[model samples]
Target chain A: MSTPDDTQFEAAFADLAHAAELMVDPVDSAVIHGRVRRRRTTRGALAAGLAALLVAAPAVWWLQESNGDENDPPPAEETTATATPDPTTADESAAEPEGGPDGQASEDVEDPVLPAFGDLVGAELELPEFQPDGGSLNDACPSGPATLADGTPEWEDGQWYMHEGPVWVLKVVHTKLEEGGPTRAVALIGCMPVETMVRQAVVVAGDGAGGWEVTEEVALGDTSDFPLFDIAPAATAGVLLMVTDTETTGMYEPVPVDYRIMRYRTGSDLEDVTGEAYLLGVTDIEASVEVTEGEDGTWRIELTLTNAGDHEAVGFQMTACGSDSFVLEEFDLPPCTADSEGVAVYEGLAAGESVVEEWTFTPPPSQEWSGDEDSGMYLLGDVRPTTYSAEVFVYDPDLSNNGFRVDVTPEDVA
Target chain B: MTPTRGTRHPPAAEQPLLLRPTLEFDDFYAANVRTITGQIFAYTGDRAEAEDLVAEAFCRALARWHKVQDYENPTAWVRRVAWNLATSHLRRRTVAQRFLKRQQEVHEPPPDGDRVDLMRALAGIGERHRKAVILRYMAGLTVAEIAHQEGVPEATVRSWLARGKAALAGRLAVHDEMEER
Candidate 1:
């Protein structure tokens, strides 16, 4: 029988597996959720700032043009009309020349005005009843405004309020997803206290009579962090690319982690089509440890860090620590003190490759270290034990399984 | 590793937004975090490190929950991420030491003597063999599942298991001898 007697291995592994079950502390998922939200909020704020810059640039240019020409007509008397041209008027303007019917600048052929933020956020429209899950809104906590007058949303007595006046509209896009389709309004609505609030992506379609009604809504969970300032039409028809801040932001330019694909049809609701095309660049690297005794009665520690992935892995740093003061509480790898050092890899590790690092160290003259030596303890001086660890820096996409550790005791020495 | 294809995920537009399930993330995290964390703990041998790695993995999963939920096995994906995190954490000293440095005082007790011995023995084996053994015995994954997870053939997994068991048995035997001495 090629199978070695596994009775003892089974028992030991079983013990380890059982012990692992006990190691888990009750995690407060809310803390993690909060962290995710905070990161998202930070990214969103950054995006919004950039968007403000873009918007301000055009305004700055217009101001310069007006300042340069004293004869330029005064800014058209502030109008109640929004940036969204009335469909009927837009058709009329398109049918006519650039100038008026009377050969003067016509009111119908005016430049598009920027919509007031107040108008976009304060428009009278019906929002879909939002439930956290598929449950009814009635089951959700009571929602109210921060106060009756201010109407700022607040949480009171475990109930959340959305004050009557304005909901935070993160983005408002007037482009239609489908070609030759009605230009519908898409609003990304965020709740107050953006970091903790779960929000919705709402699609509003204009009623034949001119009012807008929420046609569809998607409840983006607390963890979803969409970029606030950017929404672009995808090259493909009926598709909208909604940027998210899930990936690392570049130093100079904001790099979106990925886009959420929203596809819409003339008669259908907006749908999230972000499917299996969302692929992550992942590589697996396995680390193994070995210990051998030298003829000089010193222990030779050998660590084999292998690139187990099929492709070359690049841009990783390594750090190693060796110490006799190996108390569980004091176990650490930084401050490289006299006992540790960090290594960096300049080149990439090819597939199926291995990097071997070895360290030879002598134990103290006396070996009276006592304990369960088999329990990952190694003797250094009188009773102090030695522990060692080596690790590679985490890479993008997948940040796990990149390091190795070893603990040595005097018994391993010759 | 490519997970086996299962039921095709229905398009989000197919169902009305209100009717579509929105509690998937909450339920998925609650259902799998402990198990995935435990598996990573067994792999990393350090409880605090395992917890941190698993938490990071789950956070990444949450960042892409909308897309991840449509996967064939979301839990398996989370577990793979956590396991890879643990593996990567184990190989690099600075990052791991940095992570360990920030750890609060560990409230959980250390593993018993037997568990420590097992971890030590695991450290001495071939990486693939060790992973196969853990995935099989500790994770309760069948040989075929280990094969799929490892992107190896089933027979290769069986071979690793046998060799892993033999190597582990030998290491434990040595430990037993040392105890007797």
Candidate 2:
């Protein structure tokens, strides 16, 4: 009789690997070979053309230099979309308060009440003991740009390799597991002004070695509005609160720079919320909705909005994104008078006050959307996605809000 | 993450210089495609995804074949790309899962086949240890080669192997016992 031992572990793994080998078809290089060949030919031609262009570029530049008009329209640069005029984009008379690299709230009001940073975060949220000393590209962060203990080049190199362009490690908050065996830290990151206005929430996991490993990074928003950003940890075990006074731009129409705060949970779920919740320094706007089937065979979607802040709610706009099985389409909103921007505006709600609104989704709505029948890319394994989402963009100077959605489910009336 | 482990990745500008595929690359692909696919398949229990990721990694290598062939082990370059693809694929899946859940958390087909016994056993160990085992057993890389590829110490590779095998042996025995009963 024979017994399995250390060698048997390799043998056992080898057997299962052999079994797994059969599960996948041998990767065919023919398609890849042809694709590479075509790309190479295209590249060679492009290089030759670029060489010719490069040779003639100096003459073109010389001619343009001599013929330069002092006031030729600058390149079609993207003008900031913030409703409140930014000092960077405004004339001297329209100058706003100084904005930090992290995009803190810029005060323009004669006596705008600005809350202190310490008051922004929750009582339970604790700042890290070893905070990064500096907030510039050249500054060394004592607790960040996590290096792996394994001594990999990325670990050994002091560069914050995960970020592009000049970046600042604004905040690094961690929760250590028993005697600091391993620590999980969330670093608030901001790129130089040249980069996009995207602030990042980077989660660094401490490897057993002295160094830290960057496990996750999520881009929260643009800097122009999040001028005053606050973070709340321990609010959710796997969730991190990214409270910033930002706007949901890319809406084409310009809305005021209302604070659009969101919750960033650490787990793998894409982002847990859309523009559905807000918790700013002094402004906390909570929204709840009820979905029910009506006697007329239509779906009733009722929305209740509440102000949990010290200030009164001045303006709030509601926009809905509807999708047929596989895509989000412009919502077929209920019959209601629209503002000049064509959005449904709810104005005037006092602090600690709640207001209710309702909308109805009629019957005869198609739940299934079709796609390529042959490949079945549309199928979420025998089912198709048929849901709708509604997001509210708040228009308060100090606060912002988000919205939620409803879907046809067995438990809920479809 | 894995791609940056080796000597700096051949720069993006170098791809155009390799205007044509050499017979050397064809020979290299012929020798290694099967083994790399098997390794990735074991790494990810999904057959279709393994094939797709492995193919994508090769496609990248083929584009940079001129410089890639010059690397100490071009196969390792493909492996790194495959591994990165796996991480990115998982991240994208997580996003899609959330979207689908919000859309309608209804019927989703269970994965097609039973995952390999080795994957279940490997799950009990840490990620780095599991990768070491797969690199050793499935990719047939030597301990020194894995150490170089991962940019870890040779002793670290050996330790990972010892711990991984020890953990795997017990998991496999328990799995076998349960299957028998």
Where model 1 places Cα greater than 4 Å from the true spot, the runs are A1-15, A44-414, B2-5, B8-22, B94-109
C-alpha lDDT of residue A123 in model 1: 43
lDDT tens digits by residue: candidate 2, A200-251: 5556542322123446554444455443243333222222344344522222
What candidate 2 gets wrong by more than 4 Å, as runs, is A1-5, A37-414, B1-20, B91-116, B123-126, B152-163
Each candidate's B-chain TM-score, in sequence, is 0.76, 0.70
Best by lDDT: 1
lDDT of 1 at B44: 60
> Cα RMSD for candidate 2?
23.0
In model 2, state the lDDT of residue A85.
42
Candidate topping TM-score: 2
DockQ of each: 0.14, 0.15
